[model samples]
Target: MSILLIILTIILPPLAVFLQHGLGKDFLINVLLTALGWLPGVIHAFYVNKR
Candidate 1:
């Protein structure tokens, strides 16, 4: 990952996922994860981005 993506992931997980992937399953799931908790969203964003 680049500097911007890492920053976005820490700051806003969903946005990171959106940038890495798009408006699809990963993005939708990241949205939910964010709704649930910031940490979870960040974790999921990292996981999704890894994939």
Candidate 2:
């Protein structure tokens, strides 16, 4: 993961995944998680970005 992704993940999880992987399952999951709660989205974004 890059610094920008790390920062974006904290501020906007879905956006971070969108930047890395675009509109797909990961992005969708992040969006849902973000809608539910900020922390879950952040964690999922980090996990997705790392892999």
Candidate 3:
């Protein structure tokens, strides 16, 4: 992943997911994960970005 993705994923996981995959299930999941906890969001963002 790029530096920007890493930074975004860390700072705003939902935003990072949205950037990579747009508005969809992954984005929604990321938003939910983010609401649940920062770490889960970050992990999900990274996982989504990696794919």
Model 2 Cα shift for residue 48 (angstroms): 0.2
Score every model by TM-score: 0.93, 0.93, 0.95
Q: Kindly indicate the candidate among 1 and 2 with the higher lDDT.
A: 1
Give the clashing residue pairs of candidate 1, or none. Answer: none
In angstroms, give how far residue 25 of model 2 lies from its true place. 0.8
Q: Evaluate model 2: give its TM-score.
A: 0.93
The digit string of per-residue lDDT tens for model 2 on 1-51 reads 678778888999999999999999999999999999999999999999988
Candidate 3 per-residue lDDT over residues 9-38, each given as its tens digit:
899999998888999999999899899998
Which model scores highest in lDDT?
Answer: 1
Question: Which residue runs of candidate 1 sit more than 4 Å off their true CA positions?
Answer: none
Alpha-carbon RMSD of each model: 0.6, 0.7, 0.6
| Candidate 3 to truth, TM | 0.95
Clashing pairs in 3: none
Ranking by lDDT: 1, 3, 2
Candidate 3 local lDDT, residue 20: 84
